[model samples]
Structure formats: structure tokens, C-alpha cells
Target: MSFLGFQLRWNSVLLGALVTAAVLNDVPPSYEALVVLAPVIWADRTTLTWVRIRRR
Candidate 1:
């Protein structure tokens, strides 16, 4: 599936599923995965901010 112009890849989907499962099971995600995800999360937030500014 695509969001905006970004294509959601299988690994991204799978990782999201796994993360959800972990949360439901009351398990914390590993620091390594968090580190890997940090930039992507930041970029998403930054992009959202940019889009909001552009829309106004």
C-alpha cells in the first residue's frame, strides 16, 4: 500500500505487525530496533510538519 507517494514495503508491514504484537503481549521492543527506527520516525514527523506548513 502507498501513503502519500511512499510505497509500504513488506518488511515495513511485517515489522509493524511484530511491533504491535509485542505491545499487545506487554513486551518492550529492543534498543537496537528502536535505534534503527529512530530516524524513520523522525523523518515521518518532519514530513508531517512540512506538509502541514505547505497546506496552510
Candidate 2:
């Protein structure tokens, strides 16, 4: 799979896991921050992928 495809799959899994953890743990503030940061990290990965592709 392409980098983006791989990233999407893993990100989905990570998000699911985070959601499950939050639910089980009563949604801690740190988990909330991590949940929010997940997408930002994913976005950064996407930007890096594009930069890599462009460089090649």
C-alpha cells in the first residue's frame, strides 16, 4: 500500500484504541489531548509524505 493508505489504516486503529481507552478510563484529560493530537500528527505525516514524493 501507499504511505497514505498505510497511515490511514494505522491511524484508524490508533484512534479506535484511544477511543476505547478513553471510554474505559472515563476520558482523562491527557487522553483527550492525545485524541486531539492524533489527527495533527497524521496531518504532519501526510505533509511529510508529500514532501518525500515531491523530492523523488
Candidate 3:
């Protein structure tokens, strides 16, 4: 195993575990909360996407 391969695999495994831990720890989460927040984030993306739609 080369240096790059070892580093990439280590990062992927570590990140996957960290994300799983965070999701598993969040009890009784509000799933619909993201549904409400989705539009807000999309609107906040950038001026380019908006310009393409002629919103501004």
C-alpha cells in the first residue's frame, strides 16, 4: 500500500464512522424540519442560479 492509498482509506473509514455516530446519537430528530429549511438554503445558494431563473 502506497502513502496515498493508505491515507485515503483511513480518511474514508474515519469519516464514515463519525457520520454514523452523529446520526445514531440524534434521537427523536425532526425529519420534516429539513423539508422546511430546504427552500431557504436553495434561495441562499448564489446569485448565479437566481439570475438563470431571472429572479433578479
Candidate 4:
């Protein structure tokens, strides 16, 4: 798969895992969990930009 596809897939997986964990624990996701998501969000955006530029 392409870099964009890989990043999107993993980002979704991470988000799903976070939501599932919160549900299992009977609590909202914590700040730490959101912190972990921040990097994934950044990487996804970076990868998207790189891919778009490379395709040009």
C-alpha cells in the first residue's frame, strides 16, 4: 500500500482501539490517550502532503 493508505489505516486502528478501551473501562478516554493520537494525526497529515507532492 501507499504511505497515505498505510497511515490512514493505522490511524483508524489506533482511534478504534482508544475508543474500545474507553468503553471497556466505562470511562471517557483520558488526556494520555489523546496525546498518543496527536502524533498519529500529525504523521497522517505529513504523509498526505508528501504523497500529494510526490504525485505532482
lDDT of each: 0.61, 0.59, 0.45, 0.69
Q: After aligning candidate 3 to the native by TM-score, how far in Å is the CA of 30 from where it should be?
A: 20
Worst 10-residue lDDT window, candidate 3:
45-54
RMSD of each: 7.4, 8.2, 15.3, 6.7
Tens-digit lDDT string for candidate 2 (5-35): 3344455666677668888999654866787
TM-score of each: 0.44, 0.40, 0.33, 0.49
- Clash pairs (backbone) in predicted model 4: none
Tens-digit lDDT track of model 3 for 32-55: 744654555455422222122233
Candidate 3's C-alpha lDDT?
A: 0.45
Residue 19 lDDT in model 3? 53
lDDT of 2: 0.59
| TM accuracy, model 2 | 0.40
Once fitted onto the true fold, the runs of candidate 3 whose alpha carbons sit more than 4 angstroms away are: 1-8, 27-56
Across 1-56, the per-residue lDDT of candidate 4 in tens digits comes to: 24443334677677778889899999998898789798886665323333444444
Better of 2 and 3 by TM-score: 2
Error of 3 at 26 (Å): 0.7
How many Å off is the CA of 1 in candidate 1?
28
